[model samples]
Target: MGIEAELITAADLPRLEQFDGLLIRDHTRIDNYTFAFAQRAAELGIALVDDPVSMQGCSSKLRQAKLFEAHGVPTPKTLVLTRETLPIVPALLGLPCVIKEPESSFSRGVHCVASEAELVELVTALLAHTPALIAQEFLPTGFDWRIGLVDRQAIFACRYHMVPGHWQVVRDAGTPEYCEGRTEAVALGDVPAAVLASARLAGDAIGDGFYGVDVKDLDERCVVIEVNDNPNVDAGHEDGVAGPELYEAVIGTIARRAFGAGR
Candidate 1:
C-alpha cells in the first residue's frame, strides 16, 4: 500500500482535490468541518472511509438507539429524555441508569446516575448543550467488548475493562487524571458466536464501513452498546496482539478503495 497520506486541516479543504480518496479520522459532527469535508469529498466523487451516511448514523445516540431497536439488535432499555421527560427516567428505566448527550464520545457527556436527585441535576446541566438526552438501563458489566469491523468484517476484538471502583471503562470522575483500562486483543474465532453475530448485525445496521461496535455480554446474551465510526487503531493499544495483520488489513482496504485494486 504505497498511498501517500497527509495530515490536513480546515485550511486545506481546497487541496483535497489532489487526493484520490479521503480517510476521515477526525471527530465528526453534523455542522462541523469534518462533515464539510465529507460533503466536499462526496461532491468530488472521492471514496471515503466513513461516508456521510455512516457519519450521521454514528453521531447521534438517539438515532442509533432507534436503529438498534428497529433492526433487532439487543440493547439496554433506553429512553429519550428532554427537560419535560427527564422526571420519568427513574420510573421508566429505574435508578442507577446512564444518561448520555446525543453526540458524546469517549465517555464524555456520559453520566451514571444512581439516584433521583443526581438524575435531575445532571439532566438539567446536560440539556444546556443538547436538546435531548438518552437514558438507558444500567447494565453493570465490569468490561465491554469492542469489535472492530472493516467493510462489515470483524478485523479485531478486545475486552475494555473498567477502572477499579468505576462504572464505565473510561472514568471521568471530576478529575483531569483519567483511568484507561487494559485492552486485550482476542482472536475473532475465539470470540463467542453470539457476540460476533451481534457485532455483525450492529455493523450492518450502521453501514458497510470501518466501525468499532461496542457491546456488553450479559448472561451469555450480547447487547449492543453503540457503533463508532472513527474507532481507535493506535500503534500499541488497539493493535497490540495482531498489530501487523490489523494494520495491513486496514491499509489494504484503504489502498483498494483509493486505487481501485480489487474492483
Candidate 2:
C-alpha cells in the first residue's frame, strides 16, 4: 500500500497525470477534498474504483439497508429516523433494537437497547454524535460469518469469533484473547447456498470491488447483517487462518479490472 500514497489536490489532478487507475479510500464521508478530486478524476477517465455513487451509498447504513432489502436480501429490520420520529421505533419495530449513526463505521457509534427506556437513552446518546441515525433490529448471535467477495465471486470467508463479554468485533476490546481461537478461513466450497445468495445480494447491491459481506445464520435463517466495502483483511496471527493465495487473488482481480487482463 506504500506505493507512494500521495495526498493530491483537485487542481493537481489535471496538472499531473501518470497512473493506471485511482482508488479513493479517504473515507469520503469525512474527507471533502478527496471526494472532490475523486469526482473530477472519474470525469477525466482516471478509473476510480468504488465509484463515488457506490461509496456514498455504502457510507451510510440506512442506504445500505435499503439497497440490500430492496433486492430481496434478508437483513435486520431498519428504520431511518429523525429526532422527532425516534420515539416511534418502539411502537414500530417493538422493543430490543439497535441504534446507530448511519454514517459511522467500525462500531464507533453503535449501541444495542433491550427496552424502550434503553432505546431512548441509547438513541439520545447516539443522536448526540450524528444527525442521521438508523434504528435496526438487533441481530442476535454468538458468532457471525464475514464473507469476503472479490469482483462478485467468493474468495475467502471466515467466522469472526466474538468475545463472550463483548458482542461487537469492530470495537478494539484490548487483546483478542477475549475472543476464541483462530478464525477458520473456510474455502468458498463450504459456503451454503443461502449464504452464497446473501453474498451475491450484496455484490449486486454494491455492484463492485473487494467487499466484506457480514452474514448471520441465526436459527437456520440466513440474514445479512451488513455489507462492508472495506472489510478487515488483517492476517497477522499465528493460529488464525491466512490463505496467501486467497489474498493475492483478490489483489490480482482488482488490478485486472482496473488495468487490463494481460498487463
Q: Which candidate has the top score in lDDT?
A: 1
User: Where is model 2 poorest over a 10-residue stretch in terms of lDDT?
Assistant: 173-182
Estimate, for each residue in 130-248, the C-alpha lDDT of model 2 and write its tens digit: 77688777776776787877677777778776655666764452446433433556656777778878877877788776677888887678888777765667765311354676556
| Candidate 2 wrong stretches, greater than 4 Å | 1-16, 23-37, 128-131, 171-182, 236-242
All predictions: root-mean-square deviation over Cα? 1.9, 4.3
The model with the greatest TM-score is: 1
lDDT of 1 at 114: 93
Candidate 2 matches the true fold with a TM-score of 0.79
Residue lDDT tens for model 1, 1-263 = 57777888889898888888788888877878988898888888887787888889999999998888889998888898998898788888999999988988889878888999999988888888889999999998888999999888888999989888888888874578988877878877788888899999998999977899998989767899999997988777778777798877777777787768773
* Runs off by more than 4 Å, candidate 1: 173-175, 261-263
The local lDDT score (0 to 100) that residue 5 gets in candidate 2 is 43
TM-scores for all candidates: the values are 0.92, 0.79
